[model samples]
Target: METLRHIVLFVHLIGFAVLFGAWAVQAFGGKREFTRLMSIGMSIAAVAGLVLAAPWGLPDGAEMNYAKIGTKLVILLVIGALLGIGTARQKRGEKIAPAVFWLVGILTATNAGIAAIW
Candidate 1:
């Protein structure tokens, strides 16, 4: 249904927000809060993304635009991976370079904007 699709889309977007916000918070605050918030948010976001990717029977063709959506998904995955690395590093009491966080945040925002249009 159209409504279901929209709801799924909304949830997916929220996931991205969680991820982006987590990284931003980490960038500003110290590792303590960063680790806590980022972990929780990323978990929720990843689950929501999985839910949104379900194969619902609609037209069966490109629900949105595969190429654009694919690009956005790729970017998100890359950011997610980077965040995961950051988390791992944090666990070892090592701080990742701040620029990495900034870059991830910027890329996430850009992907979100692209997703909005495409």
Candidate 2:
């Protein structure tokens, strides 16, 4: 069970990497549009994160940090929303606001920071 937990945690980090890597490529490569890869990465991260939030493999008497989990969940949801909105708008020949594009990257980094620090 502990090994499984570690595997899931590795996957969670990979998801973050994929999401951020895709965003970085677009943001710095002269294009600021959403891609399917971003959505896929988000899904991976969200699912793995939810799994980690559970207490399945934890040792006895170890309490889960609900507050931190909740905070990260909320941030993830916001990132999802932004991705959806930006993608939809882009598909309709609309230009996504610079703020919206930048926020996605900012929030992604923030989420990783929270996971690492808290």
Models 1 onward score TM values of 0.73, 0.97
lDDT of 2: 0.95
Tell how far residue 26 is off in model 2, in angstroms: 0.6
lDDT of each candidate versus the true structure: 0.68, 0.95
Candidate 2 lDDT tens digits, 9-109? 99999999999999999999958898899999999999999999988999889999999999999999999999999999999999989999999999999
Clashing pairs in 2: none
lDDT of 1 by residue, 1-116 (tens): 85786787677767677767777776677452245555566666656666566666356575645677568668767777877887688778887877766777788788778866
**Top lDDT model:** 2
- Lowest summed lDDT across 10 adjacent residues in model 2 is found at 30-39
